[model samples]
Target chain A: MKIGVLVSEGPYTHQASDSAYNFVKAAIEKGHEIYRVFFYHDGVNNATRLTEPPRDDRNIVNRWSELSKQHNLDLVVCIAAAQRRGIMDANEAKRQGKDADNLAEGFRISGLGQLVEAGIQCDRLVTFGD
Target chain B: MFTSSENIDPDDEGGVIKKFMFVNRKAPYGTIYALEGLEVVLISAAFEQDVSLAFVDDGVYELKKGQDTKALGQKNFSPTYRALEGYDIEKLYVERESMEFRGLTEDDLLVDVQIVSAAEMADLMVEQDVVISF
Candidate 1:
């Protein structure tokens, strides 16, 4: 099934995003396609490219990037949510005149319309939230 | 969107299909999800689709009983959920595990809904042709 996942929580802060991450990996391993991963609310923090975890710990942000790289998945972070939380891509960082861009590659910044579109285009939409 | 004689299904796969599920996961007032979820349901219902909403995790607060938004400085949308039935969106489901984890029983909720197990909830998601989560 074509699936889109909403990650509104954290993988490191708690179990919600971690579970969601595992679900995405497992779904991909089972030969399902992930249409997109929509990050909203606090979920936008998952896109922060500067996240650096200990060597022994799981690098969730890197994992998200790797997931997108491996599957060529659509990783869209809500622009409204991302900007408000200071999560910016190259364009947004340039527009905001920020020193750095936190939104990693393989992810795009968009509005909720994309999420609505994912709903219409994908077969299933699952949410992982706090 | 208003209903008409002609067929219309915005959430339909190809034709004017019925039934759309919206999964909401957020506090009622803090995030825009609670309101957006209602809008989707209303709009889909106007398109003449069978609309059902599910609440999991913090989303369950969208249906907590005895809500007083005045203290939180937020508009009470709990009442809006009551109007869902008027829109023909009566199939509201609450995750049993979420309720249990949060210590919220049916009595603590704003409306009466079917309590679905984790596996059942997952199946319900898989059963939907179009599912949107917020």
Candidate 2:
């Protein structure tokens, strides 16, 4: 099935980021086509290049980068939300005249059209949340 | 009648808008639901949806007055709810029993909001063509 996964909560917070990593891995192992993984709300924090997880744990930020790189997956962060929360690419940082670019590589800042487009493009839209 | 997949008729201007109901059910300080709910509400309004936001359980925290996130160094979205009316997505409602359970009264909220019983909120939910929860 072509799937669009919505992550809105705690896989990026108090719990481990393993949930995000395993979610991508499991979907691939199941032979599913992931059309897009949309980051909204606090999920945008997961795409921040500044995340520094412990040395023993699997780095979910790096995992997302690999998944996006290897599969050419569309990793989108809502641009408006990203801006307010201080998560942005270099171009966005320059445009907003902010000194820092915090958004991780392999993730693009976009809009709701991508979410709506994923809904139309995918066979199923599964959400992973709090 | 034009469903979501159908084209809008030039003569029927009101028919062109997509109607959306957002059900928000989490507390404001701990979860991201409130922020995302407002985000989707604004985005749906941008797409020209006749959007309404209904609060239940701890979701009532979204409208509480004197919200201060500066102490935590978090971005304060409390101000954004005020901007909803500007987006034309102003139908915000709350469940009466939920407000009571949370020890909140209508005046505790920042904006002028409607209060409805859970039963009435359920009825409104059915009227929406697309119901999205946050």
Candidate 3:
């Protein structure tokens, strides 16, 4: 089955990102195709390359970026939500006249239409959030 | 910068049309979920799919009449609910128990809606291809 995932919470403060990562990994292992992983609300924080964790703790942002690389996943951060929370890609940063861009590798900024498209295109759309 | 076969047009002729339901369980204010959830509903209107919105729990407050956010310094978005009809998204369901619990009735709402019992709401949900809760 083709599946789409929506993650709507920030990392560290919430277990949503972790749970979503595990679910996506298991789904891929089980031979399911992941259409896309959309980050909305605080979930867009997962795409920030500036995130840093304690040496012993799991780095949620990197975990997502790595998995996205390994699977060639479409990791999309909602442009509206990301702007509200200060998550920006290089182009968006330049357009908004910001000092720097922090969008992590393997993730791209896009419109909410991507989320709706995921719902329409995928066989199932699963959400993880507060 | 990346493209693939998955990026097909949502409005493609003879394309799959699924029943997409947006479940709102939070109040309109005090949190961003209600506002952000409504954003998704508005965007999904462009997809030309069978879409519906469900109001339950504190979400029932979202449709209440006379909501003024001036004092809270927030955008009073209640009026946008009425404009949903223009987007062809007219299927709005409000749970009867939730409305009564909040001391609200159909007359208290700013827009027209179908009051559904919990069982009926469950049936509606089960019939959908995708249900997204906010």
Candidate 4:
């Protein structure tokens, strides 16, 4: 099955990101193809490289980055949502006159149209939220 | 649990029409969830999939009439519910228990919706291929 995951909340505050991560890992292990993981609302915060937790704790941002690296996953954060919460890539940072970009590795900021496209293209669209 | 050894039916493959249900359980304006949920529904409508909408809990407030967000300096999005039918999205289900809990009636709603029991709504959700909650 081609699965598309939509995460709508940030890590720690909500269980959405963690649930999505676990589901994605399980799906991949069961021989399913993850077409895309589209992050919206506070979920865009997951793509910010500036996030740093305790050394002993599980790094959610790094986990997502590593998962994307290992599976060549398409991780897309909503540009509109990201801009509202200050998550930007280098091009967006330059255009918006920001000091620096903090978008984590293996994630790209895109539009909500990508979410719609993912729904149509993928066999199943699963959403994780508060 | 799904297994790799299990054979997938050809009819249930790539081109199969999927039932997509957008479940709304939050109130409007207070959080960005309701508005963003609407944005997703609008985008999903263009895909021409089997789509159904459910309004439960505080989500029933999203369809209430006489919504004046101007006091809060927010956009009045209550009127947008009326335009959903134009996009070919006619299946709108509102939970009876939720409405009763909130003291809301069908007459108070801006748009027409099918009033269903909580059990009926759950059954509908179970029938869906995908359920996106907001």
Candidate 5:
């Protein structure tokens, strides 16, 4: 099955990010094709490269980055939502005249159209949020 | 950038046209869910899939007419419901119990929606391949 994931909340503050990560990892372990993982609303915070967690705690951002690197996952952050929440790639940062780019590795900024395409192309589109 | 298989016809895979239902359970203005839900619906329509909008609980209030969010300093996006038909997304189901509980009637809504019983709405949800709750 081709699975598309939609994460609507940020990490640490909510359990949504953890649940989505576990579900995506399990789905991949089961040999399912991951079409894309779309970050929307507060979920855009997951793609920031500036996160720093305690050594004892699980790093949700790093986990997603690892998954992307290992599986070649399409980690997409919604351009509109990311901009409002201040999550942008280098190109967007330059275009908008920002000081720096904080988009984490393995994640790219895109439009809501990508989410729509995921729903249409993937066999299953699962959403995790509050 | 779009993927290589972005244009693949859904039918070509297994002749399956997935039924996607956007379940609205939150009220507007207080949270971003309702407005974002509408945005997703409009975007999903471009893919030419079987999409439906279901309103239950406080979500039914999102369609109430005479909404003015000026005092709240928010944009009242209720009028966007009128544009759903333009996207060919006509299936709008509102829970009868929820509407009555909120002291609202079909006439109170700004757009056309079928008032369905809880059981009917459950059936509609069961028929969907994907249910995205907001």
Candidate 6:
């Protein structure tokens, strides 16, 4: 089955990102196709390359980026939410006249339409958040 | 103004329209969930899908009439609820128990909605292809 996941919470402060990662990984292992993983609300924080964790702690942002690389996943961070939270790609940063861009690898910024499209096109749409 | 380059016309995809329900369970102001969830609803309206908004728990407060955010310095977005009809998104359902628990009635809301029992709401939810809660 083709599935789409929505993650709406930030990392470290919430377990939503971790749970979503595990769920997506398990879904892929079980032969399910993940159409996309949309980061909305605070979930867009997961796409920031600037995130740093303690040496012994799991790096949630890198975990998502690595997972996307391994499975060729479509990791989309909502542009509106990203901008509001200061998570921007190189282009967006330049356009908005920001000093630097921090969008992590394997994740692209898009509109909420992607989330709606996932709901329409995918067999199921699952959400993880507070 | 960022848009999805892969945005496809629903008609091009064989016109497969699915039931998409947005479940609001949080208060509109205390947290950002209600407000942000509404953003998705507004965007989804452009996709021309069978969309519905369900108000449950503290979410019932979202539709309450005469909401004044002046002192709080927040934008009073309750009026946007009434504009949903312009987007062709009129299927608003308010769970009866939630409304009663909050001591609110249909007359206290800003927009017209169908008051449904918990069982009826469950039936409607079960019939949907996607149900996103906030």
Measured by lDDT, the strongest candidate is 6
Candidate 4 segments exceeding 4 Å error: B1-16
Q: Residue-wise lDDT of candidate 1 within B52-130, one digit each (tens)?
A: 7889989888899888879877677788788778877789999999988998889998777989998999998777777
lDDT of 4 at B134: 89
Model 3 per-residue lDDT tens digits across residues A1-130: 9999999999999999999999999999999999999999899999999998999999999999999999999999988889889999999899889999999999998888898888877889999998
DockQ of each: 0.10, 0.11, 0.44, 0.25, 0.35, 0.60
Q: Model 4, range B1-134, lDDT digits (tens) per residue?
A: 01121122323335646787889999998998888888778766656778899999999999999998878998887787899999899999999999999998899999999999999999999898778888
lDDT of each: 0.77, 0.74, 0.91, 0.87, 0.88, 0.92
Proportion of native contacts in model 3? 0.47
Local accuracy of candidate 3 as per-residue lDDT tens digits, B9-59: 557625768899999999999999999999889878878989999999999
Off by over 4 Å in 6: B1-11
Docking class of 6: medium
RMSD of candidate 1 to true structure, Å: 6.7
Q: On residues A43-95, what C-alpha lDDT tens digit does candidate 1 reach at each position?
A: 88888888888899998888888888988988888776677689899987898
Q: What is the DockQ of candidate 3?
A: 0.44
Q: Which of candidates 1 and 3 is the stronger one according to lDDT?
A: 3
Q: How many backbone clashes does candidate 5 have?
A: 0
Chain B superposition TM-score per model: 0.85, 0.85, 0.91, 0.88, 0.88, 0.92
lDDT: worst 10-residue window of model 4 chain B: B1-10
lDDT per residue (tens digit) for residues A51-73 in model 6: 99999999999999999999999
Q: Is candidate 4 or candidate 5 better by DockQ?
A: 5
Query: Candidate 5, after superposition: displacement of residue A21 in Å?
Result: 0.8
Q: TM-score for each prediction?
A: 0.62, 0.67, 0.95, 0.87, 0.91, 0.96
